[model samples]
Target: MHESLSFLAATYVGQPIWLWLAFLAFIGLLLWIDLGVVNNKDGVVSAKKSAGMWASFSAIAVAFGAYVYFVYEPDPLYYMSPDNLNQQAVLQYFTGYLLETALAFDNIFVIGMIFTFFAVPREYQHRVLFWGIMGAIVFRAIFISLGAAIVNEFTWVLFIFAAFLIYTGWKMIFGGDHEMDLNKNPVLKFLRKRMNITDTIENHNFFVKKPDPKGSGRLVLFATPLFLALVMVEVVDVIFAVDSVPAIFAVTKDPFIVYTSNIFAILGLRSMYFMLAEAVARFKYLKYGLSMVLVLIGVKIIWNFGLYKGWKDMTGEALVPYLEPQWSLIATLGLIGGSMAYSWIKTRGEQNPA
Candidate 1:
């Protein structure tokens, strides 16, 4: 099955450092221009503006998608048959993008809650989300690298990932603890034990350094709650990554497509958070839909494993073969889009009362 899928794992993992650096710089430039130039407005980012930004980024992705399509298909680079060009590449990009975006929807929901928890002003929310997404990019890069390494070395790691997805799905569907207990976090505890934390948040600043006792120095430190919130966000990101990264692997093993799409999806997340924050609460059923997707994908992964191991009889296999990587990608994207659309329509109907 792996051979048949035309896995481009080596091509992606061996992506040049220069290429990676250039990609990072481009994304960073866009982010700076977005926050500094286009969205210099003082008030909340309105729906119209947010929608426009979403469209712009999506258009960029599609243009890149066309380049990828033309480069690989018909034109043919390193492959023999034009059809030999892996469909997994395109599907993987789309699947990884969809999974990352859906996972980010949960992140946005939590960010909204966090903003409410702190009573942060609307104008500052974008700044916070910007920093949060920046942190997420770093953390997720670390996560995807570690995860890809493990999954590459030990195929059984997929089983562990599948189990994790099932457990996470169960929790999401059952509505697990949504409480944000700062005290329970180890980083917060350590900070409380070692340092003095101000009772009030001062102008939403996360860090404040004191003058050094030795005369010519400074001691830098984060505000206690800021540290706590940062820790909380990191924890949430790790949880989401565990489910999302594996979900994409079920689509394709092409790390370039997976990682690139993941980056693009996350790069847009701060803007998405601003746009979705208020409306998220109304889409109560969306979590259930995502949970179901997680469960279904997890089951698919397990079933594929069984098929690979030849656990099923020939007749059983003949009846229903394992899901293909391309089909899996398409299905995952379709499910997420359909679920969001359904939730939006339902929410709209409720608002209209007709």
Candidate 2:
């Protein structure tokens, strides 16, 4: 019993094993409630319900941030006495979570576009988003794990990550308007070429078995457009992770914090999409705001260069960047908030003509 307890208490990826297990288990419970209780039926989630769901999930993330503040051990090794969570730990977690959620605003736009391109109905969209996000949760886990490992081993990679984010941000801010042509998506093409897909979604199912036209006595599993949409969503997730993973790492190298923050932020996207799907593009300037957010996070990483050890863990060291976690959080809120408000006001003016 003691050995078992000790095993759970052992550290993994800069956090105790039990903490990881607890967080993951809690997430599993949330998903079960979503799948089994809250969203058991195939129906369009109302805007009111979607907003409520987003609020609930955001509340949970905030509460968990508090939990992290109270329980997270700065030194997982317990080298120092009472290494309970400090302001910096909580700040980093909040900053990462907020950054990820901000980035997802742009992602929701693409996802909304994907669903539109596939001509998916409101009812069937739920299943696609649920499963696609499930896949995202898994893939992002791998990406975060690999990322944390790489950054921990080679800190110089922070510079590389910063450079990539800044370059991408610049492109986003200056890049001419680009539209997604789903027909040109390589993943979609590959899936289409390989799978015998139906012209339309079938009873909200991703696949349906049909008798092949080849005069065989066997049924072949045919993928539906539903499945194709799910694939596109999954593909989009991988593309976005390249930015979000590094953006989070710019704040902290702890895999546990990164994983938890990223997942929680993603949990809100399904609801956000439901609430804003048909209207996300109306907020024209929001994209620029999110792009600037990426730039802010990137610039935060590059602040003070290597002179202050900016990206290092703040647990025991005083070498944290000059732009501290609190400042990052504040600036992040400002950029996201200001851009959104500005976009809202401008969009309303165009609609109202004064």
Candidate 3:
């Protein structure tokens, strides 16, 4: 009996099996409540309701971060002192969460664009985004697992990730306007060729059986614009993950921390999307903040690597200082908050006029 219990609690990929299962169950419960209770009906979600939902999900994420601080064994392997380990793990989780949430705003922009391009109605948008979130969960899991494995094997990959982040951040700040032209999107073009699609939405159904467009006396499956919107949403997330997954890896290498933070940020994104979609144009400075975050994290990764090598060469003597996870978290929050404040003031001034 003791051996069986011990086996169930055994560590896999640096976390106990039970921990992983608990996290999964918690996420499952949230999804169930979201789809089954809070938003069971097919109706347009008002901005006020979306705001309340965002707050609820955001609070849950913060609580989970607090739970990590209190319950998790920070240094199970005893590498760092207990206090330092606890601080580092908790700080890493929050930093990863904040960074991911900030980066995810870019996704909101893309999602909004996709829905507008498809002319998706407000009520049906939730259904597409809900399914999109489901796909994101699976996709992020695979990305995180693969990323953790690769980084663990090749430590130098961190440098590459850092460099990529720097490049991406610079481009975002200086690049021309990013417009999503559905006509130019290869995925949508391909789908159009491969599937029979309807010209209009069919009451929130992704696919509906209809009389064959070819005038045959049989029913055929036709993909609705809603499904195309969902597919585009999924594809956009995959594209964004190329940057976001690496950005989080720059924060911490712990698969548990990485995965949990990523999932929590993503879990709230659908509600966040609805809440901010109509007001996206108001936050003009948000991209600058997001750009700065990526660049800061990239620099932090490189700085830490330099400190590690310098410490080794100096025979345990400290050389260059490294940016701690806590400081990184502070900087990220400041940048995001400051940018939001600036955006609000500027927009308010413009609205009122001198």
Candidate 4:
């Protein structure tokens, strides 16, 4: 018993193992409540319900940040400490959460496209999204772990991530929105070729046993269009992670911080999708705003990379030092907010054009 307690007390990725365990347990409970109680029936999720879910997840995220600030360590009292680093952690959490949520807003449009391409029914979409999020959770963990390992071992690699973010952000800002041709997606084509896929969704079931078309009267499990949509959604998340995981690392490299903020942001976005699915086109200019957010984070990373390497030692107390987390949070909020407001107004103008 003592050994078990001690083991829980052990630290991993800058946090106690027990903290990680508690978080996973909390997330599990939330998923149960979501799928078992809130959405027990597989009907169309209303925008009002989506808003409520988003609010619940956002509130949970805020509560977790408070927990981090006040109770995670619980040794010297984080906020009152001389250095006040605990407060910094809370800001980083919110910053990372906001950044991730904004970056992933584009996903709603993509998801809508995926569902349309597959002709998935509204009743079945929830199940696909639930399983898709499950896949995302697993894949994001792997990516974060690998990224954490690579960055911790070789600090220079962070700069490469920074460069990648800059280039991607530039593309996002300048590159006009292009329609994705799911028909040409090689992943979809490959899955269709390799898997025993059904022509249509099979009553919300990912896999259904159907009679083998061969003369044998045996039942064979076949993948449904629902499953294909789920896989495509999962694949889209992995692609988004390539951009977001690095961006969050810049916010704060604490894997726990990065992972929790990321998953919660994703959860929030999943719910928000239902709210915005039909109206995603109204906020079209948000693409630039999100892209600029990435660029800003990249610049922050580059500055820190240079500052810590040799500039800090040379400048000593004279330099501005690392980019402050609070300012990053503020800048992120301002950029996103401004973009949202502008997009809404422009969209309204176009719709009401006299």
Candidate lDDT scores, in order, read 0.67, 0.82, 0.86, 0.83
Cα-lDDT of candidate 3? 0.86
- The digit string of per-residue lDDT tens for model 2 on 57-122 reads 999999998887887666542111223346677887898898898788788878888888989998
lDDT of 3 by residue, 68-105 (tens): 88888653532222457767888989998998898888
lDDT of 2 at 11: 74
Ten-residue stretch with the least lDDT total in model 1? 72-81
C-alpha root-mean-square deviation, each candidate: 6.6, 3.7, 2.6, 3.0
Candidate 2 has an lDDT of 0.82
The per-residue C-alpha lDDT of model 1 at residue 121 equals 70
Model 3, residue 249: what's the lDDT? 91
lDDT of candidate 4? 0.83
Instruction: Judging by lDDT against the true structure, name the best candidate.
Output: 3
Show how many residue pairs clash in every candidate, following the order shown: 0, 0, 0, 0
State the displacement of the C-alpha of residue 217, model 4, in Å, after optimal TM-score superposition.
1.6
Reference-based TM-score, model 4: 0.93
Error of 1 at 39 (Å): 3.5
Candidate 1 residue-wise lDDT, 1-354, digit = tens: 886544433344545455556667887887888878987555677767777787777777666566556653322322212454555456556666777778777788677666676566776666666667688788777877876677777877777777877888898878664756645767656767777565555554676665544566767553645544555666677767777888766555555566677878877777677676667766666677778777877787777765543455554443346566567666666677777777777778465322
Between prediction 2 and prediction 4, which has the larger lDDT? 4
Which 10-residue window in model 2 sums to the lowest lDDT? 76-85
